[model samples]
Target chain A: MQGGWHRYKEGVMTGVALVAVGGVLQAVVGRIDWSRAAFPVNLLLLVLFLAGLGGMHTFRSKVGLFDRLGRLPASVSALGWVMGVTVLMGCIRQTPSHLLSDGVEVWPDFSRMLSSWSFVLLYVWMTVVLGLVILRRIYPFRWSKIPFLLHHVGLFVVMVTATLGSSDRKCLRMTLVLGELGRFAWSETDRRSVELPWTVELKEFVLDEYPPVLVLMDKETGKALPAEAPLRWVLEAGVEQGGFTDWDLKIVRSIPEAVPVAEEGRLDFVASRSVGAVYAVCLEAVHRKTKVRKEGWVSGGSFMFLGELLELDEHVCVAMMDREPRRFASRVVLNGGNGVRKEGVMEVNRPLEQDGWGMYLLGYDNAKGRWSDGCVVGLVYDPWQPYIYAGILFMMAGAVCLFVMAQSGKWKEETV
Target chain B: MSWDYFVYFAVVALAAWGAGALWAWRGRQVGWVYVFTLSGLAVFLGFILSLWVSLERPPMRTMGETRLWYSFFLPLGGLITYVRWKYKWILSFSFVLSLMFICINLLHPEMHSKTLMPALQSPWFAPHVIVYMFAYAMLGVAAVMAVCLLWLKKGNPGEREMTLCDNLVYVGLAFMTLGMLFGAVWAKEAWGHYWSWDPKETWAVATWFGYLIYVHYRLEVHSDCRKSLIILLVSFALLQMCWYGINYLPSARETSVHTYNLN
Candidate 1:
């Protein structure tokens, strides 16, 4: 029992010593420049790391520490340390590297935990422990160990590939304007414009917006009425009705596309699909307490007009809020530099893959809404994603085994 | 279909669950307990189905919508646990916890809308969210079991009860793993990256690690009942942060894409 306690204490000291070395290295060398380890460098490092791990496992009988580190105490300590660092990572606000150049004041090391040498070293230590665990189980393995192997090896693959392959992953953005051929894209990492192999021209942009909503606004503060838990009624042309806070409201008429018109000293809206058209609604509101009625045409307005509201009283009025976009897509014609042409629609959550690149719709001009003629597309090329998916599959299989084992009471109970 | 009729469905489901709990506590007519519990599930599921149809999409977008799933799963978990372990008190505990969520929903209803954003219109949305809700329900049951086995039972829990709690955690972790993987795959398909280390993702990993430590400690190290039970409660607290505590964190509020537009 004394020997066992001493070994556990030694294992914890080793873990703490590793952390100290990491902190010292972090202070000396600054953050790890991952881009410096791209491609062959990462591959070489991985090979060396594995070779060392295998050598350690083979010499476990010779080195007392190797056998000790392979035991549960060391593994648990490593996991506990990882958990501690991860908790710290969650608490700190980690900024993306590209955004670091924006001149915002942030903690030097913690702000970029992913790139900090201490964080990287801690993960490397974890991988080493995990590698030893996997090696221990691999020798003289039975079918019963398959689930354990899957879980550990799967995690190992994900950690190794995601870390090393991150440097090779490329994310860039391209903008396509209607009727204009575009080939240049802005790389997110290095912040430079690069010409693409293919050109894309936006043929049409479609934006489907949800119907505008009406909120009772305080005429003085110009904010939603009732201050807390403000009520909103979605306008659906003569179909929906609701009451809120002493006011019964109804949509008398609605127009999806309309422009303001003035004729015979009366301001009204005419339905049109012309430029700068806005969503206009006719509302009738009744004050339940006072038995007073108010009616008028109101609009959330567009780039061309300031919105109009119906005065319910001196204190409050019925105001229209801007229509929220439900979905937006850009129809584009892609021309490969080699004379191949293809047409596709790119939308959020729907990426068009072509020539080893995924093109995802990122943004449109919020000011122009549906009338915007251009859209930003994010292009990404990640070769390591397939390996990551394989790892995910292995972990999923192991998880299934765990579930089944737990449910059937087949787990081998350790004697207490 | 809408929250307007939620009170009726809530009351009916509560009555069925309450009756099932009473029947379970009496330790008589197991068939009647199953009947009552299943009827409650069916009625609640029917309401969800109607809401899904009326909304023209899965009702998994808002905080209130997720609560609807939580309430449904709590009793469902209770029934499954009772079926597996024959725990008479499980139903009463789940029903009371589930009732609290139902009451909250009834009092503070959100605006009902049929508009689903473009980013949410993925095939992965429903399964990802539903699986997570189920996982949360299972873990919640484990936490309640921990509380009972620790405090209420005066830390003298039977081995069978302890094993049952462990098994619940196993099931919960299994589903949580799947849910996180699904989210990662969907994120890769939707966005450019699989994992962005966003605040929500960070908290989720912390939560996963917390439970992992408990599982390892219980399985390999000493199975001190008190220590394991305490670990369970701590892990549950981490899960709470991953669930809704991120919304209130200033660091998370601006950065997390997982934040639901609650209003």
Candidate 2:
């Protein structure tokens, strides 16, 4: 009895230490905003503190209620219930179209439902039951307990962190115009405008396009043929198109930007270094049956057709230009109210993080290519990110431990 | 390599898988079964490698591209299970499932463009997808084993069968956990949020929780084989939804960043 008492005291101390560590981590991670009374952090601390103390054998031995609640059947049933409800919610959220058609706002409605009193009660009840079951099962930890502890504890930590951090999480869309400071963002939940703590000035916006390709099309049917040529093909002195059509077309020259010039009473093409320019291809075509040769410049947004009758030939031969935007990015300078300044490049999949805020390049003005007016960025402020990351790390470590323990062949010798 | 070459290799690989299944059924020398199956896997891997080399990127960008890896891993997983448990019918079931995916690829060939979108050109893209596909393969095998257990005489599965099923679930769950963690980490880097609650993500978490419940149920209840089998089957269906069924969700089509423009 004396030895059991000593062990119980040690467990209690350990539990207290664990909860204390969690509280300190929360404070350090900014999860506990003291300015707001840190209610969420305090609530989490209280819950963990109670859980830690209850995990002690001394406390557990004094309370018959925990033992009764720790019944395996009850825990399993509670888990099933939670999983069922969560899945149902998830299924409903998966059909956004249905929700929209039903006049239900997806995220807000889902969030409201999750935070509703009934849902909260259910969530808390199941969490408590599950936690008790895990605590009871893991009290006398052995090698075999590693997998169970990792999986369950990791899950509990993640869910708790997510819940505690939800109210502090904020997402907004910010549009930055070139050469102008942007200090306002539209809330993602609602389109209401909100002022940000920092000003973002777009230094420049760049759009990169893939190499242009020339496509052959049947003007009559308006159907594209399979024949395609790269921009390099324009540089070639001549090229044959017999495989694509009955006409044989030869490229005379190509220019990135072409402007027409009248030389000797005939039209000629010359390269122009203009801000807004179109790709131009000068070609010579020979009719297969008539053996007549013709030459002209076919610029992007300009049409050229070849045939016996001008109108009839217009339906027989056509050329189309195509190019896809490969990537877009924004160079921006962020000026914070705290007098901190930073410069960063924001691109898709590469976000700019500064002073607890992340700015992601969502898109750019499609009509203006390299000279776009500005870019659209999504700004996110999540105080719970550190906790979430910690939870992920813990979960990953737990998973690895379980996997390694299983492979070490020691688990088979220990009976659950 | 071109789609034509892919088709040729796929046909040959499927033929080999069929022959291996025949040998397994006949109770022929295990060496011949190993030879046929391993050769099939080799050919399949070669096809993937060729496509990767030709495309100048990992063949994990498109739905059909990822399906190629799934087709390969499913049989590989079944072969491993068969070798471990000496289960005769495992390879045949794996072959049929693999054939279905291969046929899907043949019927609806997607654009095999050489260019990968900037978002897909990340270091995490390959491992995140590869691990998920491997986990799916393991779970697929587990589901097959559960079905076999369910069909046993009087629905009474022997201890050996139960152990096999449990072991499969354990390994599959570990892989699933790893895959999910990798994906979350990748998403944090690319999308600025670790958990967006996207439709695919929601389904994935639901599937994970479903399996979690199954594990707890098996441990706590000491349930009968039929009940366990049902749980596994249901978990497998959730896995399917997480994998591709989410694509059919209209909300996902509009809002999910993960959707693949297969057309």
Candidate 3:
């Protein structure tokens, strides 16, 4: 029993030493500015570092103490405990308590909770345990073990990079006025003014909107029937509605920008102001049974008058509506102080990345246009992004490998 | 083609498929049910194809549009599971769930426009959503299996059903992992951050972890069937929250960038 206790103590010490070495190596790598290095050099350095670590882990695992620490029943139990707790905490963070409150109002603040020493210790412990398990299980790697190795290693690298490089992550919101040079940003968190390395001279901001669509609605039932074609095509085709009410609707004329005009006591459409210009469509609806016809001009946003209730039958009343601006996007240019520049369109789902920072089109003043001011952009500097991406590649490759192996019956003999 | 026509055709096909499922359940000629199931799937695919042609874009933008794919894939997943495990009741359960979604789409039709939002214009969108729906369907089947296993505890699952359940969980988990990875990559391209811990993403991770727990429990602990089934049921709840319930969360409703308004 004494000998067993001594062996266990030796294993614990070895595990702790290995973890310390890993932490130091990660810190060293985290301090390196890979962005400043040439692409080939960065690639070579990353490969060499990974190889060194892999070699060290393999060598350590051959030692009985290190190997035993990895295979310990307690380690698996601890991993399960940590994972379960982390998931619970994630769920709690998404709850109303954390979500409804602002950062200042949040009790036991989320960012604080994540950055706490205990949380960090737990995170590091889980990572170290998982790394040890992967290292021991994947040594003298067979084709079957590759998936496990890649996945666990990928996760380890992602966690290490994200945690160690937290201080390097910076996010700021900037309002780039049209044709204005903006060089300063005030960090709300730090409560300090930060001088930007490059001046962002906004060349232009273009916002493009989608074309409007017309639809016919039943006033009583509130059932809308959308037209399949544009105004011009609708005029040519002539839509016929046949369920319960037989009405044939035809577009008489369509104007892109128009205003209501009282011409000879009759409401007519005329070319109007460019801003807030309403799309007007002149429609003629004919009742097939009654042989009665009514004509009206329906302008977008003038739903009250534009939707004159046309009596189709004793039970049916119809009106016209227009659906406009399904989506919009912003195009901007980023001019640097070093005479370097990059131009890109920032639409939803597409952000601009430049020199370790990413500029996202958060929103714009609804009244603004290509020549207008006040476009909100979110600038994020996350140094760990490259590592996260690399981790994703590894995980994806691992998944594909496992899937292919499963399909090929390579895992048929495996139990877990 | 109008939405009315699409709805009418889909309803008729679903009714026929339902009748075929009933016939199969009643121990009639199984081939007829297979044919009807395939026919139903084909009809739904045809409707989706027609919409794609008319819209001039992949019909995967809105909730109604995605429901079309979900409705199709649910049965496809059920059929695969049923074939692999020879579980006769699996198709029936899947059919019912698919029918419910189809009804929801028909009853509350969202505005069907030809416009694709710029964010959804990515190449990753289709595959990401498609794989997720497939994974959801498979997980749904697994949950049903779990429920059956729990209810019929007196009767042990045959070796085949047990294996089928485990394999389904494995495949579903894998697909879920792939979906999360794809979304992360897409997020990096779109939002500039891979993991924002946004409510939706947080719930997604919770769901993933929930299933991971089940995987570990099944593989390492070798727990009893009842315990495993309970874990699967809990994981399924998490999956549901990740899929749609997240939208109702105050955080998601207020601040989530992922909430694609149901309307």
- Give interface RMSD, per candidate: 2.8, 6.9, 6.5
Which tens-of-lDDT digit does each residue in B82-107 have in candidate 1?
99989999999999999999999988
Clashing pairs in 3: none
The sequence of per-residue lDDT tens digits that candidate 3 reaches over residues A1-416 is 24223433543454455435544544454322322443455556456645654664667646653444464432544444444545544445443322234564233333333533333444555566666777667646677677777767777787666655555567677777767777887653454567787777665565554555444454565655433211212211234222223567766776766767789997887787555456676767787788788777765444222433445555454444444333445556666768887777776667777787888776666543322455777778876678877888887776666555543445434424
Q: Write the per-residue lDDT of candidate 1 for residues A17-72, one digit (tens) a residue.
A: 76677667777876778889888898898899889999999999999888766766
Error of 3 at A78 (Å): 5.5
Query: Between the candidate structures 1 and 2, which one is better when assessed by TM-score?
Result: 1
For model 3, what fraction of the real interface contacts is kept? 0.32
List residue ranges in candidate 3 displaced over 4 A: A1-107, A110-125, A185-193, A214-250, A259-269, A283-297, A301-333, A341-346, A367-374, A405-416, B15-34
The superposed Cα distance between candidate 2 and the true structure at residue B215, in angstroms, equals 1.7
Q: lDDT of all predictions, in order shown?
A: 0.83, 0.69, 0.64
User: DockQ, per-model, please?
Assistant: 0.55, 0.36, 0.32
lDDT of 2 by residue, A382-402 (tens): 887887877787788776765
TM-score per candidate:
0.94, 0.79, 0.76
What lDDT, from 0 to 1, does candidate 3 have? 0.64
